[model samples]
Target: MRAGRGLLAALALVLAAPGGLAAADPAAEARAAAESLRAAGNLLSGAEEAKDRVAALTETVRAYEAGLASLRAGLRRATIRERAIARGLEARRQELGQLLGVMLGMERTPEALLLLHPSGPVGTARAGMMLGTVTPALQAEAEILRAELEEIATLRALQEAAAGALADGLAGVQTARTALSQAVAERRELPRRFAASPDALKSLLENSDTLDSFAAGLARDSGQGPAEPGYALPPLPLPVNGTLLRGYGETDAAGISRPGVVLATRPLALVTAPAPATILYRGPLLDYGNVIVLEPAPGILMVFAGLAEVYGATGEVVPAGSPVGLMGGAAPDAAAFLKAATEGGGSSQPETLYIEVREGDTPVDPAGLFELDKD
Candidate 1:
């Protein structure tokens, strides 16, 4: 009987050990989701093209929304677990109190008094055995109480971390909302290439195979005569403040060589006319998103591509520093850019704008002409 009781006590102590009661980390998933959303926001803020801006902002918003959902779900799970822990802790406390009470009563009574009273030797012997069994059981209960206390502390910390994440998620949503609003507003103000008859222009575009062909056709149909000579290049301002991502003549991953300089800038960065110029074309062309071609001088053409939006219309002359368009800034999948940069052994190219200068049909090196230091 004593051996059986001792074995039970040992099992109880093992079950009450610290490792036995550990719960899974409640905040891990939420933390990961928050980090992903933050990375997406960083990429979005680095975008510099117009066609990419709305799409990027929309993705940022979606990520924020998803993060918020994850946070809420984490809070709910934490709340439920907290309630369960509280109930379990309370029950353990009550059990501990009962055991302590009995132990205290026994301690107060003298051993001599117990031996002299009632059933004498047999009663005292039985009491001694009971004390032995109770002592081990009491120790097991005390260990369980300690473990529960630690568990509660861990849960509270997880809850606090979750709350902080939730607050950050809310702030991200607001930032995304403001960015989206600005992008939409800019799109609404942009001048249309064919405001009088868009259908006629669409028909003309459908028949043209290349952007240059389209520009020539439009000019001929509009009755504009051949451009005159004697035009000189003006001092041009940098379209955006950024680092050169890729220079002319550099070949990219797909074996395609760049014909112009590609600048990587902050998301939604304003693109302005470098010199007083007339817009020759403004629209999507080939793989480029929104493109804007300008004539700063006769026979010298400046081309801006990979924009999120274009501001001026065909044949409209605009002064230097006039807002030509905006760079795309939406970071829909920042991870992809990061992965590509890592795998390609290159620096991250977040938002990029391609600028090409042409003399007739021949591409020119714009690096020699533009004073980029002023930006």
Candidate 2:
């Protein structure tokens, strides 16, 4: 009986060791993860807002420059070259009138006014003939006027040429303004995206040493049980409301297993968390566009793909139903991802959303969890 009791005690210790190792508190994991996810989400959210402001400012600067160029062009077009010519012609006409008055002696003697009329009837006819003969003098005056007018015309031409060059310069300034605005916009966008650094995440995933080290610290006080059966796990709230153009699961064009689900929605729609979780990774994968991976619990991970912009960071936690990032097609309404050729003759492209579930190192049917709650 003593030997049997000792053997039973040994067996009990052996069994207890495994349980202790596997023991995890789901609630605690969820809380810790949720906090990380939230931080990641906030970082992303702030970045996105900054991006929007920059974009708007860029557009405004472009518009202002455009209007400025147009105003310059209009001023050029409205300027008159004729005014200069008119002033030159008026001066010449006044000089010719004075010369005629002096030649006719209409400006002196006993009857200066009478000189303009004639001395008598015979003189009147002679004066009339003299006036008619003044055509030669008038012709000479006109020749001088024409020469002066030509000079004025040349000056006017120069003015127009200068205006055209000024207009060109203004156009160049406008182009530079546009380029500068766009550059600033891109510069602003680059830092947020660069700082999060998807490449770092991919590296971490590839060589788990660093991540494992980090995870070790997090796991020190870890309390979570073995993963529960993934059933009726609510489909992650789409960044925006829209139809799912493509369902989860299928061979992609490259003949690779479509790793996750796709949710089709409008451009820039906000993608949110499916459940409380921590961002295990926030970066890009080969086929995934702007990927975000959130671990809700041990053996359960959520992935978001084809993000126009990402809003989360590694080591950040989020609450269930919190905003992850916005969904984006091409514009306000369009699909971002193309469709794979169907087995049937016709082709189908859908705005797709991808989700995946993993248990340890196994890929299970994600549909099971999504389908369970469908009404």
Candidate 3:
């Protein structure tokens, strides 16, 4: 009976008191993320000459971005689990000492007596009876502890491996972005719209004080795009891979609300055209930062702001998924990335891309116009 109690105590000492096994397999998720990276690497191996090089590299860059995001998420999960287990062990340090004592006592006692627990004839019978129930539980809990420790080790190994892969990923995406930019610059096959009138655009840039005013000017131009009045927008991808920072009508830290959705994009991320659109204007505009104004259909104009570099000339009709610009900011290198992952919080997306849609002259919410990406 006493031995049984000791075993249970030992089990209690090692057993984590918080949540049980996580419902999702973060390791599996990490592996899936790695697979995505591998795919990107394979596609980019000789991507410069692929017939659809521009499109291929575009997808490649996006794949790398999405994969890296997934990897970050997985690393964060693994780190959090490892820390929780460590905290559990640290909290029960004294209990663990007692557990050692129990284990040592078990070693000294006779095997038959260990099971029988010689309290007395009546108590002995009861201990033997309890043994049947208790032994399996002790083994089970010990196995659980072993598994948890192994999980910590696996997580640590994963983070270390991710460092090299993440560095390579960062470099790879940058290379792809550079290639995509050149490809877009050389591209001349896209259909054309009327060239932006420099004097008119220049006047608008100088006179317009707000994004709304600038957008309204560029959109009202008759030759900006094919006039299809009351065009119902189909769900299209957001210009960049990102998470939603602020939705339309959401107030920010400054307590200002806008009729636009703010997306938090990774540094130097590529921004692609969501659909076929004619570039009405592409340059630094008002307070919105580097902006690309596209009239997808007459009466519907989309504005992408906060870019580091803009591609294509005004009046170039770009197809869906065409590279239009790059997001502003600098990404962390591998060392910093791994350090952040090991530290167990998460990575930061420093660049903000503000997207707004105007239907005719009215500023409308853009959230439903684009399919939002969670990663």
Over 4 Å off, model 2: 1-202, 205-240, 333-350, 371-375
* Tens-digit per-residue lDDT, 1-375, candidate 3: 454555655465455443233323776677688778888888788687698888889888888988888888888787778788788777866776676667667667787776554566888778777767866777676667656666776766676677767877888888888888888888878788767679988988898888888877777664544446656889987788888899888999999998898999778988999999888889898677899988888778888988989999989888899889998877788877766655745447888999999886788888678876555
Candidate 1's residue-wise lDDT over 1-375, tens digit each? Answer: 343344344434433433222343544554566576676567557543545575566566556655554544454454555567667755565564555455445556665674453787888788777767766665665556556555555656655555455555555656766676576456444443323257767887789786556555555554434446644475566776556767777887788785688887645555777887777778897777898877776556788899897765676766666667777765424333223322334433368888888766567778867754312
The count of backbone overlaps in candidate 2 is: 36
| TM-score of each prediction | 0.42, 0.36, 0.87
Ranking by lDDT: 3, 1, 2
Task: Please state the error at residue 193 of candidate 2 in Å.
Answer: 23
RMSD of 1: 14.9
> Any runs in candidate 3 off by more than 4 Å, and if so which?
1-24, 111-124, 224-229, 344-347, 372-375
Best by TM-score: 3
Return the candidate ranking by TM-score, descending. Answer: 3, 1, 2
Instruction: Estimate the TM-score for candidate 2.
Output: 0.36
State the lDDT at 357 in candidate 3.
90
> What are the runs in model 1 whose C-alpha is more than 4 Å off?
1-200, 215-231, 331-349, 371-375
What is the alpha-carbon lDDT of model 3 when measured against the actual structure?
0.78
Q: Encode model 2's per-residue lDDT on 248-317: one tens digit a residue.
A: 5666676755545555543334456667777666555555566676667755655566775555555566
Per-model C-alpha lDDT, please?
A: 0.61, 0.43, 0.78
